[model samples]
Target: MNLKEQLMQDMKEAMKAKQSDRLGTIRQLRSAIKNKEIEARQELDDNGILGVISTAVKQRREAAQMYSDNGRPELAAKEDAELAVLQQYLPAQLSEAEVRDIVAAVIAETGATSMKDMGKVMPQVMAKTKGSADGKIVNQLVRELLAG
Candidate 1:
């Protein structure tokens, strides 16, 4: 099943199982996806849906960090829980080695000889990683590889 269909199935299961927290998170995700579709005036394919989920995950991580820094562990824990739920829809994350290899390959393909070519390299790396790798990790790897 596609992501939207999978999410709807999970939502129904959450409701049937009386999983209030999971249900709420799934509903919020569905709402966000709907909003994105409306705003774009088009139905999102899997890649588009993944982009939305990625954005939500990033927001949750930032919110959780802010809550922790503000001494609000309860709120931070809630954000973490939601983040976990959202992450279930994402592809398996890339290992550090995998990300490094991909970044190196991208640099080679783009002929990026120095840090100056970061702009040219990053997009190709991101495309190859396909949301499996974190942007910060990929950027750091690219910089390290290119700097030397």
Candidate 2:
């Protein structure tokens, strides 16, 4: 089944198990997906769903960091819990070494010998690594590769 179908099934299971935390996270995700659909005026495919999930995960992570910085561990923990729930739907993340290797390959493929080539190389690398790697990590790797 597709991501949306999988999410719906999980939501149902959460309801049956009376998992309020899981249920709440799922409902929030569903709401976000619905909002995007309404705003974009189109049905979201798996990649589009993933984009929404990634955005939600990023928002929660930022919120958690902010809460922790403001001395609110309880609130931070809640955000962390929501992040974990959202993360389950994300594709497995690439390790640092793997990301570095991919960045190296992109650099080689694009002949990006200097930092100026970053813009040229990043889009190709991101296209290849989308959903499998984090953009920030990939960007850092690219900078290191170009700097070296």
Clashes of each: 0, 0
lDDT values for all models: 0.92, 0.92
| Cα lDDT of model 1 by residue, 67-145, tens digit | 9999999999999999999999999999999999988888888899999999999999988887688888898999999
lDDT of 2 by residue, 1-148 (tens): 9999999999999999999999999999999999999999999999989989988988998999999999999999999999999999999998999888888998888888999999988999888777777777888988999999
Off by over 4 Å in 2: none
Cα displacement (Å) at residue 43, model 1? 0.4
Looking at candidate 2, what is the lDDT of residue 63? 98
Which predicted model would earn the best lDDT?
1
